[model samples]
Target: MTATVQPTLDGTTPPAPVDYETWLAAVWPHFIAAAASGRTFTCYSIADTNQLPDPPNPRAHWGRLMHQLRDDGYTRPAGWTCSDRPTTRHSGVRTWKGTAAAQREAAA
Candidate 1:
């Protein structure tokens, strides 16, 4: 999913629309920007004179997307937080730790 461009059947048309953001989650950051959503899929070939491959063009926008995701990290599912880092405050760092723990224990 990192690559948005679909593999080509021949050498011209691309495949169905596959949202790159939703597709590549495993290699995403915790926070993504609105600008990242505007990117779309395109295709490129690896070989200089040989035919292009299907479903994974190295020259397509998808390739760039994957490069961006892999290099910078783009969180998936539109709003899914990046899995690599902790977004919320750590549990032990809370000032009211005892009270929070008591409340959680009582609720349980």
Candidate 2:
């Protein structure tokens, strides 16, 4: 039987909780993996990355993951300048690219 769709008291369904372990898993969707790989060669604007790599990824919800990856040395900024585009957390977003370490990680 199909489940009936129901709206919540707030007229919206609550967001599903993130499975942190799964989100952190090495094996991700091809798009996410590809984006990570692409970063090694080119920079991507975070604002434009809202629907990146095609197919979709959890990054749309957990944008901070990109910053985490950068902090971990998996990615780096294209430059010191903030993007002209706006974001939820910041007035302007930044561009990022994969680092050599990320390339090696992707290769593995």
Candidate 3:
């Protein structure tokens, strides 16, 4: 069945979604770079800054990515802050900070 697309909360059209694995691979490097920067950031901020493709299931995929990064020792939950995503209307969001491993990865 075809999935219905919904307009973002800001009334803008969302980017067309891509295959889950392909999208993940494409965005992983950018996210690693963001983590290595050693600055607190939100998932959307990294994705927006990198112009990464949207995942097939945004809600699930984004969270999954963050958790995977944490599990992989690249990032940690830093804190909470207002989201900068245009579609989110400044709602509260979780922030992440890079770990030493991420910094080392970037250097290598």
Candidate 4:
């Protein structure tokens, strides 16, 4: 039997309990494995992250990731900016391509 769709009066469900930064890091390997299996996922950005429980401030992980990117010479210098480019088809129809062939396909 189909379950009844009981609409909430206040229109809210319980918040997800995942610790956002830890959740992000823990799932990183899954995202990477998906790539090896010919799928991928979009990434989170510092600006778009949600607030988290206090102490150790949850955004620290993202901060470290950016620092590593900078240290690995993958970022710009002198007050530049970047994007959270989606690298997966599963993220729905949103953006165009990033690289050469992907751009061609998105255009075509």
Error of 4 at 97 (Å): 19
Q: Write the per-residue lDDT of candidate 1 for residues 1-108, one digit (tens) a residue.
A: 485565577766665644544444422321132223333211121111123222234236444553464354332222222222144343221010112332343345
After superposition on all C-alphas, the RMSD of every candidate to the true structure, in Å, is 18.2, 7.0, 5.5, 13.2
| TM-score per candidate, chains pooled | 0.19, 0.43, 0.80, 0.26
Candidate lDDT scores, in order, read 0.32, 0.51, 0.90, 0.38
- Candidate 2 residue spans exceeding 4 A from truth: 1-35, 40-63, 80-92
Per-residue C-alpha lDDT of model 4 across residues 44-102, encoded as one tens digit per residue: 43222433222234446545544443354333122322345354334432111123333
Per residue, candidate 2 scores C-alpha lDDT tens digits across 18-79 of: 45555445323432454456543222343245343321255463455666666777667664
* Candidate 3 lDDT score relative to the true structure: 0.90
Clashes of each: 10, 1, 0, 0
Clashing pairs in 3: none
- Cα lDDT tens digits for candidate 3, 1-108: 998889999999887756888888899998898899999999998888778777888879999999999999999999999998888899999999999889998888
**Residue-level lDDT for 65 in candidate 3:** 95
Model 4 steric clash pairs: none
lDDT, residue 51, candidate 1: 31
TM-score of 2: 0.43
Ranking by TM-score: 3, 2, 4, 1
